[model samples]
Target: MQVLATAGHAAHGKSSLVRALTGMEPKEPGPALTGTAWTRLPSGRRVAFVDVPGDPRSVPAVLAGLAPAPAVLLAVAADEGWMPQSREHLEAAVALGVRSGVLAITRADVADPGIALRQARERLAGTPLAAAEAVAVSTVTGTGTAELAAALDRLTGRLPVPDPDAPVRLWVDHAFTAGRQSVVSGTLGAGTVRVDDELVLMPAGTRVRVRTIGCAGEPRDEVGGVSRVVLTLRDAGPVAPGMALVAPGRWSPTTSVDVRTRFGEASGRLARRMTLHIGAAAVRVGLRPLGPDTARLTLNARLALHVGDTGVLRDPDRRAIAGVSVLDVRPPTLVRRGAGAARARELASWPDRPDGALVLRRHGVLRRAELTGMGCAVPPDAVPLNGDWVADPAHWETLRDRLAAETARHAAERPGAPGLPLETVRLRLGLPARELVAALARPPLRIEGGDQLAGGQPEPEADGLQ
Candidate 1:
C-alpha cells in the first residue's frame, strides 16, 4: 500500500478531489475544506490519502503529518492560475522528496478551455505532472473524473504492496467525532489495523483496543499499508494527528538528525533553537553547526526516535520556515549535509570498540541480535567464539588488553591452569557473562575449553594427574 497525499495552495480544491476520488466527504464547508483529513481506499491493497487544508497557517500541522512517503497532489484552479502559495506548497512537497504527483487542475468547467489549459501547463512546468499527471476536472461536469481515477490506478500500481504480517503502525492524521462516535483518522503506513487489535500510542506508551475500522468511506474487513483509516478505539481520547500506533520494540527515542537543510525565504539560515516535526511528534532541539551543509542537534525533549525515523522541520518563531524533513533521526552520525560534519563527530572522540557490548558488561545481559552484531557468540565453556569490534581502533585494542589481564589474573590465582574458569574470570573482570564473552572474542584475546580453561597454552596432561 503506497502512501499518497493531497497538497496544494488555499482554495485549490484538494478536499473535493479526495472526495471525488475516494468517495469520502472530508470535512467540507461552503464548498471548501480548510484542514487536513487523511483517508484511505477500501481496496484490499490500502492506499492512504492525506487531504491537507490549503491554509498556510496550518502548514506546520499538515507538514507534520505528510510523512512515510506520501504522493503529493497539487491542486490548481485553472481560472485562478498559479499563485505564490502554489509554489510554496509545491516546494514543500519537493522538499519532502516526493516529486511525483497529480497536478489536479480543478474548476475545469469554469476555466476557459484554451487559455486555462496553456497556463496550467506552464504553471506545472518541469514537474512530473507537467505531462501525464495533471487531470482537469470539474466536480459539476465530471468531464475528467474517469481519467483522474485511471491515472490514480496507474500510479498506485507502481507502489509497494502492503503486508499483513508486518507491525501495525497507524499514523493518526486526523482525530474527530462524527455523530456519536469518537473516531481516530490516520494513515496505515504498513501492517494491518484490525478490529479488537491492541495498539500502543508511541512514546506515550498508552495502549488502546480497536473497536472498529473503515476505508474509502465504507467499512472494510482489513486495512493496511499507506492507507487512510479511521480506527475507533475502545478506550481513548484526543488521539490527535501525527500519533503512531506501532508494534512493540519497533521504535526508539532519537536526539539527533542528519539532513541537508536549505534556506528558503521562509527559513533564514536556521539558528540554534528550532522545533523538529518528525513522524508523529514535535521536538525542540539545540542546533550545533558542524559545517555549512550539516549540523549536530540535541533534542530538547525525549522522543521514541528509531534509527531511520523521518520527520519535518519547522522554526516555530518564523511563520515561513515551517517545512522541512528528509532526515535520519538518532542515527550513527553519517553526514548527508554539512562540511567537516564527519570530522567534527570524529573529533568529539567516539570509541571504535563496540559500546553496546561494553554497556552490556555494566548491565549484565543483551538481546541476541546485539550479541550477534558484536560477534560475541560464547560456548558452554564461556570462551568467546566470535570477535568483538568497535568504530575506534584504539578501543578495540584496549578491550583486548583488558580481557587478557582478566584471564591472566584468574590463571595466576588458580595456579598452573591452562584456561581461567568462567566465574572467577568474569567476577575478576567485573563484567557480565555476555560482556566477558564479547571481550574475549577480540582478535588479540583467545579462549579455549579444557578441563580447567585455556588462554595462553594447553596444560601439559600428566599421566599421574589423568
Candidate 2:
C-alpha cells in the first residue's frame, strides 16, 4: 500500500479533505477514524492517507507520520494561500526527505483558485515539490475531488515497493490493550513477521511472541515492510508507543551514538541538552561536539539504532537544530583528554566498506579473525603478521621505515652496542604491545636472536652481543 501524508497549515481543511477523499466509510478497513485513513481506487488499489495537522505546534505529530510514509499530499487553503505554517511544514517535509506529493487547494469555493494555484507554485519554486501537481477542491461543493483522487493514485502508484528481506524495524506509534492482549500499531520498515515469531522490544530486551497480525482489518499470518500493521503480542509486558518490534540479534540498543550532523538553515549552535527524534522515539540527550557538523549524543534512554538512520535534533524549546545521520551507533567513550579529537579523526576516516584496512589503520594492528568478527572485510592486500595478527600494508611499511631509522640511530650512537634490545626498540617507537613490534619485523629488518633488532648492516662485534 502507498502511504500519503497530508501536510499543511492548521484550518487548511486537511482532515476534511482526507475524509472527503476516503468518503469516511465506517465499513472501510485501516485507520479511518483517526488522522490516518485509507481508500480503494477504481483500479482496486488501496492507498493509505495520513492527515497531518497544519498547526505549527503539531510539527512533531506530522514528523511522526512522515517517518514511514514516502509520499505526501500537501494541502493549501485557497483563500489563505501559503501561510507561515505551510512553509514550516514544507521545510520539515523536505528535510525529512518527503519529496513526492501533490498540492491540494481546499475551500476553493470561497475564493478564486487561479490566484491560489499561482501562489502555491511560487511558494514551491526552488523547493522539492516545485513540479508537484496542484488542484483546487471543496469538500462542501466537491469541486475537483476526482482530479485530486486521480493525482493521489498517480503519486501512490509511483511509490517504491518495500523490500521484504531487509532488516525489520517497526516503529510503534500506538499501543493499547485489547481483550487481555497487548496491541501495537505502526508502519513496518522492512523484513517480515509471522505469527508465533518472537520479536524483541528495543531499549529493553523484552522478547514477545506475535499472537496475531492485522492489516486493513484482515488477519494475516505474516506482514512485510512498508505496510501498516497492528500486532497483538502474547506474554508482553507494558508495551508503549516509543518502542520498536524488531528481529532478534539483528540490532543493538545503544545510549551513545556518533553521528554526522547537518545544521538546519535556521539552526544555531546546539544547546547542551536537546531532544532527539528517531522513528517514533523521542528522548532527551546530552550533546558533545565532535566537530563542527558532528556530535556524540548521550541518549537518556537506549534506542535500537543502526547505521544510516536519520534523526532530527531539536532544542529544549522544540525548535529544530540539526539533522543527524547515524555514522556509528556504537560509539566509543570519550574518556581520555584528547579522545574526542582522536575519535573524530577515526570516524572521519571510516570507509564505505567495513574493510579491515581502516580499522587496522586506526588501531595499528589487530587480530585477523577479530577484525572479521567486527563486520570488517579483510582486504586482500593485507599481510599476516605473527601468528594471527594482521597489519595494513601501508601502515606496516611506515612502521618498518620508522623502526629501521630508530634502530640504526641507536646502533650508530653506540658504535657496537648490541643490536638495540627489542624492548628498547618497542619503547622508542612508543608501541607498548608486543604484537605492534612483531608487525614491524618483516624483511630488511630482522630480529636478532630473540631479544635484539638488526636495523641495517650487522656489525661483526655485535654478532655475539646477544
Model 2, range 250-338, lDDT digits (tens) per residue?
66578887777643732226787888878878888988887666788899998876666777786738565466777766566688999
What value does the lDDT take at residue 417 in candidate 1?
Answer: 48
Alpha-carbon runs more than 4 Å astray in model 1: 1-3, 22-24, 28-48, 113-132, 176-182, 218-221, 236-238, 255-268, 319-398, 405-466
Backbone clash numbers for all candidates listed: 19, 2
lDDT of 1 by residue, 198-299 (tens): 777755777777788876557876776666666777556555555667665544444555444543433236767877766546667776655444456677
Instruction: For model 2, give the 10-residue run with minimal summed lDDT.
Output: 25-34
TM-score of each: 0.68, 0.75
Leading candidate by TM-score: 2
Give the root-mean-square deviation of each candidate in angstroms: 8.3, 6.9
Give each model's whole-structure lDDT. Answer: 0.57, 0.74
Which has the greatest lDDT?
2
Q: 49, model 2: CA deviation in Å?
A: 1.8
Q: Give the TM-score of candidate 1.
A: 0.68
